[model samples]
Structures are given as structure tokens and as C-alpha cells.
Target: MSADVVAGWGGGEAATASGKKTLWWRDAPSARLAALGVVAFLAYLGGTWAFPLLRYYRTPLLDLGKLLDHGVRGGLLYTAAAVVCLACYGLALRIASRSGARLGVILVFALLFSATLFFSYPWGAADLFDYAVIGKVLGQYELNPYVVTGVELAGEPWVDYAPWSDTTSAYGPLWTALAGAVSRLAGKGLLANLLAFKGVALAFHWLDILLIALCLRETRPDRVAAGVLFYAWNPLVLVETLANGHNDNIMLAGMLLAVWLALRGRMLAAMLPLAGAVLTKFWGGLLFPLIIAAGLREQPRSLWRRLAYLAVAALLFGGALALGWAPFWAEGQGAWAGFRLQLFTTSWPLVARLALERWLEPARAMALAQGLALGATAAYALARAVRVRRAELTEASYGLIFFYLAFGCAWFQPWYLIWLVGLAAASWDRERLGRAALFSALGLLSYLLYHFVWFGWGLDHFSIDGFRALAMAATVLPPGALWLARGCMANR
Candidate 1:
């Protein structure tokens, strides 16, 4: 590679003052940073190979069952690998910021990390099997996944693996259709279907990286490499989107594309992808008013022309939503299944509900928690919408998502962190980026808490409330304490 390209690969200047071109590898800081990237990649690869979830599947290459027969030990090993990878990520980011890394190096690492993790089983979640069952319901069985529970296809090989076989699909219609297409393409093999969904996630993961880079180039050119590294090297993002094969990456791709399109002044064109995002996952809908307001602000000042522009944008957004939902609506028979997912609370919200149950009836306590979450989210959204500017759109979106994930989300998972990290990548706000990184790292511990401590170690046998208390402490305290400390420091 040329010196320019090599320089972009985390290397410093390649030419000496005497007009002599030095080898790129000769630069100490760049070589060290690049080495850190490699370490991070290897750590992730090791974690994937050692993942306890692989024990469920039989593979000749590695007898994962034998290796991970002990749940506690296996969980510890996997957690250690994750911690090492996260540490490397932090060091790499710090070094890259000071030494000036480039996109070429970041992209190389992203591809390597993704490819390695792609082969590893999604140890943190069984959501992939659920996707396969849903896909089969739509593709092979010719049934609407949202309307039909996987239990109806219990005899199918894929259905045997899904944990939620009795429940209808909670995914949006757009995702259901895509999953169905992948399932049809993969045919009757269960593994084939799993890999096919993962493949789609992999494609969108790359798209997310590219779109983030493109959006940053427009809004924060100076921070492009840092932004890419923030999202690309995040362990939570890599594991969740690639290994676990969650559809959130696809949702994020749509959101990022919409942001990019808007940044390019194609206000009307932006609505399509934004709509696709909402159809993929309802969280994307939160950005609608903010995006629409920003778009409207960019229109011609003439009253008639602005009104016409508004009408066209609405029609375009509504039309896209209608098209995506039409095939699976089934006269709204089971169309609301996806929204019902929010009724099942977890994380901090669950803790809140349990505490409230001491005073109120169980149902009422849950309702109060859910209602407060909704109200808080709505208040924040309205306050943000009034002040959000075109330039502040990405940061605004990040704040909104962060708010919902922190408070409003009734069912939060580690994979949901992808939404925050994805948008934060395009933003120049270091504090938000730091918060995203912190959450991504801590989020992985949820798996440890849920899998190893609660279930694996049989802590649930003692007291479920105790386990919830532990979860609340583990997931919420660190960030909460940090935010408090930062505020106190700022006051001084």
C-alpha cells in the first residue's frame, strides 16, 4: 500500500525529512495501536469459540459441549474474554484519537472481527432460533408469523429449537417478510435458515458501518475514524448483530440511511428509509416527528409550497408504512402481537414494578411503571422536538434513544444497545459516545447475570426477588454512579 493508505491504517507519516520514505510498520505508536486492534479481534474470536451457547449444537470441529460442560466455568471464561476485548477496545480508541488512526485500519479490523464472530454461535441469546421459527411460519407454512404461533408448527425441526414456540412473532411485518424470504431461500434445513438470517444481519452490519462513516463525513469529518471505531469495535454490537443475528442492525441501517439522506438535503427521500426502520422495529418511529420537523424547516418559505411539501412527505411516509404492513395485517387479527411485547418488562423497569407491587396490586403496579415510562418518554420527545435543529438531528436522535432505553423500554436486552451505539457513531459528542461505550460493556454482563447467576447457578431456587435486586444493581448502579459523579464534578 502507498504511504497515504498506510498512514490511514493507523500509521504516522511514512516519509523522513531527508526525502526518504520509511516503512509504515516502523511507526511505533501506529504499530502498537494496530496490535491492540488485533488483540481485540482475537479476544472476540476466542469468546465466540468459547461461548456456552455453542454447547447446545453439535459440531465436529469443536466439542463445545465437552469444553463448556460446567456452566460457571464456561461463563467465567466467556466473561473474561469479553472483558479483555472491551479493554482492548478502550485502549485502541484512546490511542487512535491521539495518534490519528484512519478508516482503512478500522474497516480492516471490523471485517476481521465480523467474519470471525459470524461463525461463532450466538451464545448470549436464543433469539436466532425464534427468528428461524417465525421465518418458517411465514415461508414454508404460509402463515402470518404475527398471527400464528410457532406451536402450530411444533413438528417442524426449527420450531423444536425455539423457546417461544407458544407465542406469535413480536417482530414487525417488514422483518417478518425478510425473514420469510431468507427462510424460503435456505429451504428445509434448520442450520441453513439460521445462517441465512445471520447473513442478512452481517450485510446490514456492514451497511451500518458505511452509513455511519458517510453521515460523519458530512457532519463530523474530523471524528470519522473515532466514530467508526466506537460502533464497529463495540463487543455488544459485534456479538448481538452478527453472532446473535438480531434484526436491530437492519432497523439501524434504515435509520442511518434516512439520516444520511437528510444530511444530503433529500428531505423527501429520507422518509422512505425512516419508515422502513419503523416497520422493522417500532423504536425508529420515535425519530419521525424530529426528522419531519427538520425536513419541513428546510422547505421553501412560501406558505403554499411548504404546505405542499408537507403533504407529499406525509403521503410518502404513510404509503411506505402501508405497503410494508399490508401483506401481514390479516385484518388486524394478530397484528398487535408485536406491540404486546412491551408489556413484558425487564431490567430496571421490572425492578420498579416489583417495588411498586408492595403498595398496589400487581397489575396496577405494572401499569403504573409502564405508564410512567411512557409519560417520561413523551415529555422528553416533545421537549427535544421543539429545539432540535438539522445539525443536531443525530445527537437528538441519540438522546431520544438513550432516554427510551434507559427508562421507557419495558423489555431491554443487550442487543438493544446497537441502536444507541449506531446513532452515537455519527455524532461528535464525546460524552454520549462514552455513555454508549459504557452501556455496551455493562450490557454484556446481563447475559452473565441471567444465564450464569440466575439460571445456571440455580439462584432462582432461593429467591427471584433477590436475583432481580442483583440485576438492578449490576446493570443500573455503575452508569448511575458515573452520571452522578460527572454532575458533581461539573458543579465544582
Candidate 2:
């Protein structure tokens, strides 16, 4: 055998020849920083357990604005810590490929990161307010939130001021209904029930975090520790979903869990979470198709059984839509049609409006444009999926992330990009010339600039045009890193 093959097998041979030894630290500055980064990040997340919801109450336990404003404060802290925490996660990953017994080091980082995410509180983003508005309709007026907009629900005590809430979001009504259930349980003059909704989102987010851990464990057991940092510590996730209190985090958490289960040959079990995710946001349903493709990878009774799971999952999704409009389907076609209109439009719904307006008389063109976008993106994804190795789940996941965001009409809120950081981080190969380093630096910088401007956090709107400046960094970093990756891939 060649000398290289012998060296590659050294670790296994050494363990048999000698014995395993514990490693408490990595030698490099990057590894030391990775360890410190994990600590600062955990403390940051753990800090949120004491998050003062009462600060926002106009009265004690009722000042809603202050509570949300505090979330903005947390964002700055996040930008600082995410840089270090994620850096370690990325750099250590490359090192581990050449080392041994570093799983504990990685696991420590992951644990702290996930713990931090668990404690973080979402602020008063428009979507969170929308959840409250819908909850109030069910709680206060004894009416269906699906039938009314936030404007109509404005007279209620729980509903907050957000112009966007007047419209139905493409997010299905089941999540709203679930929020309504929380309102019913809380029976509040305070925003306690709205908080109950956040608690539920938090639980699901953590559950999803575990799901990600388990998935990484399956394909890359040693790297599971690093995987934790990527998925858990990401700032886009922190500010957008947790601090901003958006439902997409929980929705995605559910989707990722389902993806994990399906990949592990538990298609039947994956169905419920996938359905829950879809009910939370229409986008969650994308996994059903993804699962179908994944199932096609192997053929047998097990794979055929997935076909049954997919059928049941689809029926469940349609049933969720029906729950919102069962009787209304026959009596209120106009309202139902309006509800259907929401299925396609998002944050920048203007493009969808124009494309369908007067062109195909609204309805037909709307369906066509939406279908075309979906179909085109799906084609890109399936094509990319062709490269997925049995071992590299991260690459497959990141491909989905890029496809989902890039193709959608400009309707994205910044938080929509959070999930990509984890997938990308997991996929990083240090041999690929600091690809993880580039991603860690740029993904975070863009997220920081984007959120600060969007929130007016110590800066006015377009105050510094910071995002544009940050974009310059993203542009330069990738092409520059490409050569490094090329050299590594070629040399390897």
C-alpha cells in the first residue's frame, strides 16, 4: 500500500495500538477563539431566560413596546457574539477532519449554541403581531381569524398596530388557529397569551434544533458538535426568528426535523412534523416534494411505504386548508378566492399583484406565475440534488436553501435567510480554502447590516446604506475564496 493510505488509517490503528486520549483544547488561535466564541454565545442565549417581558407592558407586565424594544438591544449583542461563536464552529470543523477525539470540543460548542437559542426571545415583528391579531379574533370576538384581517381585528384588546396585518399572509390559517388556542387558554387583559404563542414557537424551535443534531449525527457523527454551532448560533436565526418572533423559525424547525427523519428512513414519522410545518407556513410543504425525491434514492418496501406517507401528508395539508374554509368554501367564494390570493403573495406582494393584474384578468395569470416560479425553482433543486453524495447531507440542504430564497419574488424578510447559515456551515470543507471562513464572515456581516437598517437600531433607515457596503464584502469574499477552494479541491 502507498504511504498516504497508511497515514489515513493512523487514527484507527493508533486507537488499537495505544488508547484514546482526551483533548481539552485545539492548538490554533482559531480553535481557541472557537471555544471562547461558544462560551460568549451560550451566555448570551442563557441571558435571555431572564428576558423582561414586563418592560414592554404599558403597566407592569403589560408594556408591550418596551419588551419588543429590548429585543432590538439583543440584536447588537448577537452581531458581536455570532462572529466568534460561528468562527470556531467553522474552523474547528476543518481541523477535526485531520484530528481525533475532538467530538467533545465540537459538542461543547453546539450545546452552548443551542442552549442560547432556547432562551432567546422574539420581539414584536409584524408576523408575531399578526399571530396576536388572529389569536384575538378567536379569543375576543369568537370569530375566525381567517375571515378577518388585522384591521378588522384592531378593535380587540390583544391586536397591535401593524399595517401589514390587515392582509392574510401566505402562511396558512392553522398557525393562526393554533395561536388562537393560546389566546383562549390565557384569558388575558395582558399580552400573556401572545407570549404563550411565543413559548410554543420556542419549544418547537428547540425541538427542531435537536432534530438537526440527530440528522448531523447520522451522516457525520464526529461533526455533530460543529453542526450544532452552525444551526444554533446563526445570527439571522437569532434576530429574525427568535428576537423578531417570526413563525418561520418554528416552521423551519419542523421542516428540518422532518427532513432528518425522512433521510433516516422514518418517512411515516416525518409526516406529522412536516404537516405541522406546512400548517405554520405554506413553505413548510416544500419538504413533502423533497422527501419524495429523497425516497427515490433507494427502492424497496421501505421506499414504497414513503409513497403512502406522502399521500397521507398531502391529504393532511389540504385538510388544514379546509379547516380554515370548510363552510366558507361554498358560501363565500369571493372571500375564499381572496384567501387563495394570499397563497402566492408575500412581504413584497406588489410583484405578484402587478404580474396578474389586467394581464390574465388576475386569477389565471396569478396561478401561472406562481406555478412557473415554483416549477423553475424545483427544476434547479432536483438538478442540484443529483450531486448529493450519500455522506454529504449539508450540501444537499444548502442547495435547497439557496433555491428557496433566490427564486422567490422579493417578498423575503431578512429572517427568511436564517436557516441557510446552518446548512452552509455544516457543508464547509476547510480544505476548500477557507470556505467556512468566508461564509462565517460574510453571512454574518450581511445579516448584521440588514437587520440594523431594517430595525433602525442606533441608525436611521438607509442611514449608513450599510447593507450596500456589506454587499461589496460578500461579492469580493466569494470570488477570492473560489481560488482557495479550487487549489484545495485540485490539490486534494
Candidate 3:
């Protein structure tokens, strides 16, 4: 690599085999910062444990009712914790950017932090238990998760703690199957099942880190460690993937693996992981246009080669859908029919329904809004595909995907930002990285308004209360202001 690439703002070399990449505190200030990052994370963990309703209110350490009654104090404490977490994230990124952190050192830090956070409270989300319930329903009862939900498994002692008990699996089939496999191995203990699921999440988290490093190695070899650290040490990623145990990380790992393979000139092989990503989460399939564009951009491209690539990609994706989802496809229209429930239950549709209730009927308004979002996303994808080339494929793809996800989607959760973070990390777009980090940090304020009922928050029910509006503003303002400022600067 050229010196400009090697000296990418950081004095440290990228993954040197000599005396440079040592773990000693003196040689590696990044390592010391990594240790400090862990300390900050531990503090965040402790604060989450103290928060009410995030964990079971009846935990031996905390009384949920008592904590909730002190609403103002509780909210303040939670906000304080969030602020601390964001602050630490900023520090870690600053250190990583300047120190030219080694990938090995960062991985060591990521593993240590993730392992400890695994034991921490789920922290404002109950998705982990919900995953376990789906697993138990599928693995133990042999029921189709696409058709049945945690409500059907209410008889199980652990089901009481899971959220969205009334809804069927919101994810794609591969995730449910993998959850079942893990559940079966977990035996009957509720704690054991939860731990097993968390372990699976942590493993996927590590896999994503590794794939990101590999992708950056291909795209920005000199800044591989910085890119990896950018995603791996992200507070939102750690909390959402490991603590809450969301399966989005697994889907992301598959997606990044496909990108890495594609960058290495293995476009055909890339389809396999892309298929796995799609089957893991349907969002993965949305990336197909970008992949196709990258393939078409290859040198010596001809009609036949393009056709062959299209045919193989289609076959792989279709086969994955047929194989992974066939069993749970339901009667008639298959799993596709069941997915409609997901749309109606999601945040955006609900918001649209509420916003348009006075002017239009709820159902029609939701349909219109959903149609518009999908149409716009499709149009954007086509435009990107028509102009995309290998030289800027990653950057262009990330932009389109982030646009659709950030503006087109109805619900904007913190973990959703992980997709953009992973892509931005490899794309070597510092501005995009800054925006994503800011959004993720601020998006977390959504939890401040979470209203846990007799059980937990469900997709079917939500209110556009004042707190919810404040949370929405938190999600929008920072990024919006940054865009406006950039525009003003350009004009000047």
C-alpha cells in the first residue's frame, strides 16, 4: 500500500507484524483507551440494571413498581446513563481515529466488552426473551412461528417476560430456524435458553466485526482497524445486539460477508451469502439491485455475462427463499401472505394511520403511506443501479440504502442504524460515519418513552404521546441540523 493509504491520519501502521502492534500499554494507547471503553460500558450496564421496567420489575435487585412511581427521577437517571454511554462512544472513536488501532487489539476489546455486557440487563428492550419464546414454540412444539406467536406459548413460564406475545415472528425464516436450533440445544431452563440466545447474538456480533474488517481491508486497507472499531465499539451496537439479542446482527454479518466476497472478485460466490442474508431477514434481498449493479460494472462485461449473473443471482435467492421459508410458508400464498401482518404492526404504518385519521380513513392512509415509501425506495434503487460502478459501488450503495432506511421506513430504531454503520465503515465516508453515530446516539432517546404495560411493549400498540414526539424529534433533529449546516457551508 502507498504511504498516503498507510498514513491515513493515524501515525500507527495497519496490522504490522513487527514490534508496533504490541499489546503493551506504552506502545498501544489504543489498548488503554479500549480498557477505558470497557469501564464506561460497565457503568452503562450498572445504570441499566437500576432502571425500572427494562429488566423484569421484580428482579431481586430492583422493584419495578417503586422505580416507576418516581417517574421524573427514573427518566433523569436513564437519560444520564444514555449521555454517559454516548460520551464514551465519542471518546473511543476519537482515540481509535488518532491511534490507528490494530484490528487484533480492537477485537480483543470487543470480545471482552461483549462478554461482560451479555450478563448485563437487557436494558430497555425485551427482544431477547421474545426470541427465545419463538425458538421454544418452533423447536419444542413444532409449531410454525410464522403462524403462531408467543401468546400461544403463554403456558411456558418464561413467556410471561417476553414482549409481543400476540404477534407471530416479525423476522424472516432463517432467523426463526436458527433460534429454534439454539433453543433446542438450550434444554428447558429459562435462564439457560436466554443465555444461549445471547451467546448466539454475541457470536454473530463477532462475525460482523470480522466481516467488516475484511471488507475494509479490501476497500480501505490502511484504515481497517478504525473501520472495525467504528462499528464494533459502537454503544448502540453492543446494547442492541448483545444485551437485547436482536437477530439483525446475524443478517448484517451475512450481508457484509457477501459484500466482502464480491469485492474480492467472487461475484458468483457472493450470491450465496446474499441469499443467506435475505433468508435471515428480507431486507437483505433489497440489496440485490446494488449487487447486480456492481456485477454489471465489471470489465469485459457483455450481454451474456450480465444475463448469466442475473440468472445465477435469481436462482440463488429464489432457492434460498424456497428452502429456508418453505416449511413455514403457511397455506396458500406462503410466508409472503403472513408478512403483511408485519407491515400493519410496524411503527411507520401506525404513525401514518394516526396522522391521517382525520383526513382519510386509517386503513387507506396507512396503505397510501406504505405504497409511497415502497415506490420511492424502488425508484431510488433503480437510479442508483443505472449509474453505479465498481469504483464507487460501496459508497453509492450505502447512500441509497441509508436513504431508504432512514427516510422511507416507518419505525426508526437505534439498531437499524447498525446497517448503515457497517456500510459507512467500509465505504471510508467519515461524514456518513459521523451522521450515523450521531443518529444512533440520539435515536436511543426513544426508550425514554417506552410504556411497559402488564407485560412489555408490543408492535400492535403505541400512542403518539408527548414523550413519543420528543423521542421523534431526537431522532430527526441532529441529522437534519447537520444537513442544513452542510448546505449553508456549501453556499458560503
Candidate 4:
């Protein structure tokens, strides 16, 4: 109504608003990083998809000559992909000090696009044939996959490439049911399991990124975009969940949704998804104690109420688990197979074998090793929570996550990192993300090495020790040095 108001809206105040943005946003490091993050992520997805397809298939179309050529070509592509993931990571960090959310968005779209293209490819879908085996066991013959192995149905060209095809999933019974249905629907056709299982994994992986972003937003609105970048563009998640084909995606999505619900004070709504998650991955059981601890924050509720609520939820999960797994219990003879000596999916099992051989008595070796490893892990988790109970940072709870992920003596797979990727991203600081990103990329080596180990070339698998050593140095050294500069402020 006033001339001054009109002037302010049309000219003078508008100028002030525009100037303020140039000063804070354009020059703002975080904003720049956020924008770049989105671009880099999409680029990573694109660059990765641009490479060779790693699917397992027995195409009558390709003979030994073709096989050799494809292998050589695939090798180069994977290497280039690794390089691309790393380069983008560097760019992300350079811009991270400017714009985390923008960077994250870039990274997310890139990685997702990369994964999408990879799966959609004819060759890329080959690696997923093993799932078809499971489907055949369930769909065609009505036999339980837990009771069978891909090796049993090994007539296909694709099964040759699914390194873990001979191995059973150790997945929750219900997951097998779903895989079987896909196989049945595809019906003894070529690449049926591959197409179906990959489709499921693809759906879940997308859901995982979206849910993780939502959880981060709900709990720490400041870090939402960054969390999405970390999970989506993350090399480990890409290789394992998207490429190698892991089922952890669905399980983790459920877990993130549960966290979101609980954080929003809808604890009751959280329980179903949490229980379902546990059924998908037994590791979800760890949330019981953490949730219990979180509930203790309110005055007058006390630890007893916390434990009681946890018990209720545990019972809730336990009941669902019993029902879900009851049908497959008799079929899961190898259910707990391959679950020995795993530690952070690092080199723990290797270390354990060497250590046990030197000192422990053979009669007592296995039991003692398992006990000590499991006990120490649990103790560390409890200790960490107690120490950080007063810390203002919500990400501090990651101590428990890191500990659990590190304890087992099984072989490490890359996408397993997705479990904690969200936490790391939500709390990501100006420190270089390149190292962790490198570790994520090297995880792809597991695919190549897995083939070597399975066909009786465990010796050859370790031949990459030279590369492993280099990768370790590259992934850890820079970050370690950066920590010294800031006194490692993550806790603060």
C-alpha cells in the first residue's frame, strides 16, 4: 500500500535478497558440494553402466573364443568403472566443503542410473541366473531352495558366472519363497531367475535410497541430501546390491523405515517393519537393544520400561520370524552355512585361521574363537553406547553398527557397507570421502576373487594381495591424516 513497501518489493529489497544469496549460497561451499554431489553421482552411474556386463550366462551364441574376449573386455570395463567411481569421489570431496546436499543428489542419480543400466543390459542380467536356480528349485520342482543349490541345476550358461550360485542364500525363508515365485512365473525359460531376482533387488535398492534419505531428513534435516548421496552413489552399495546382487537391500529398506517411524514418535507403527526386517536379516535383531536404549532418554520411563518395550518388540519379531521360517526350517540344512570367522567382512577370517592354527588347541579352537570374537564385539558395542549416551550427535549410535558389522569371521562383501552408509553420510564432514569410496570400489574385487576361490584357486585369489595392499593404503592414509588436523571431531 505504501510507496516504500512498493519500492522494497519491486526494487530495493529484492536487490537485498539477491545480494544475500550471492554472498551466502554462491560462495557457500556446502551448496556447491551439494549440487556437484548430484551430478557426480549420476555421472558415476552413467560411467559404470558404460562398461562391460558381468552377468552369468551360458549363451549358446558365445563360444570359448567369445568367452575369452568378453572376459578381457569385462576386466577393462570394471577397472575403468572403479576409476570413475574414485574420480567422482574426489570431485565430491573438493566440492563437499561447499555443498553437501547438491553433491549428494548428483551422486545419487548417477549411481542409480548406473545400476539401472547395468541390470537392464542383456549381459548384465546373466550374473543373476543363479537366482533362477533357486526359482527352479521352488517353482518348477516345488523343492525348497534352502534344500537345494544352484550347482544342482547347473545346466545353464549363466550359472557359470554366479560365483555364489553353488552356495545357498542363507536368506530368511520368506525371501526364498519370493525368489521361487519369480522363477515359477518365468517358468523354466532362459534367464528367468536372473531377470526376476534382479528385478526384486532393483526395486528394493531404489526403495533403500529413498527410505534412507527420508530417515535422515526426519532425524537430521540438515543431512538428508548427503545421506542419499552416500547410499546411492556409494561404490560398495553399487557393486554388491546392484551388480553382485545382494538381498540386503530389501531388509535395509525396512530397517530405515522403522527408524523413521520410531524417530517420529510413532513407535507402534515402527514395530511391524522392524520385525519384518529381522525376518529378512537376523542382524536386525541388534536394533532391539539400541531402540531400548533410545527409549530410556525420556525421564521417568527408566531402563525397565525400555527393556520391557524391547522385549515386546522382540517377541513381536520372534513370533513373525517363527511363522515365516517355520515352513523352511526343515529345508534349511545349510542355513547357517558359510557363517564362520567373519569380521567386518574384512580380513578377519583369514586372520582367525592363522591365529587359531598357531596357538589354540584343535579340540577347543572353534568354540573358543567364536566365543571370544562374539563376546568382544558385544562388549565393545555396549561400552560405546554408554560412553556416548550424553553426546549430542545422533550419529554416535553408529558405534553399535560398526561393531556388529566388524565382528563376524565370514568373507566380506561390499554392499554390506550399505547397512552403515546412511549413518556415515548423515554425519559426513568436510573430510575427504574418497578413502571410504575407494574401499567401496575395491569391494568389486570380491567378484573376481570369488570365482578364483570357488574353482579351487584360493591361492590365485590372494595373488591380488599387491593390489589389496595398495588399495588399503589409498583408502586409509588420507583420512587418517585428515583426522589429525581436526582431532577427529565426529564425537563432538
Clashes of each: 0, 13, 1, 47
Q: In model 4, state the lDDT of residue 197.
A: 73
lDDT for each candidate structure: 0.77, 0.52, 0.69, 0.53
Which structure among the candidates has the greatest lDDT?
1
Q: Residue pairs in steric clash, candidate 3?
A: 348-410
Off by over 4 Å in 2: 1-35, 42-53, 57-124, 189-191, 300-372, 382-397, 422-492
Better of 2 and 3 by lDDT: 3
Q: Which tens-of-lDDT digit does each residue in 1-492 have in candidate 1? A: 233332243443454446675554565545666798888887877766655334544332222223465388877876787788889888888866566555566778889999888877766666888888888898888998877888876566555567777787777778989888988999988777877888999999999988888898888776777778888988889989887788899889989898889888888999999999988887888888778888878877899988998899999999999999888777665546435634643456677787898999988887887888778888989888888778788988888888788767777777888999999988768788788888888897677776666667767774665576567577755665665577699999
- For model 3 the local lDDT of residue 477 reads 54
Tens digits of per-residue lDDT for model 3, 399-470: 776766655666556677778777777787778788878877765655655533211433225354433444
Better of 3 and 4 by lDDT: 3
- Best-to-worst order by TM-score is 1, 3, 4, 2
Deviation in Å, model 4, residue 259 alpha carbon: 1.9
What's the lDDT for candidate 1? 0.77
Q: Using lDDT as the measure, name the better of candidate 1 and candidate 2.
A: 1
lDDT of 2: 0.52
TM-score of 3: 0.85
Ranking by lDDT: 1, 3, 4, 2
Candidate 3 runs further than 4 Å off: 1-23, 31-35, 48-70, 299-301, 332-355, 451-470, 480-492
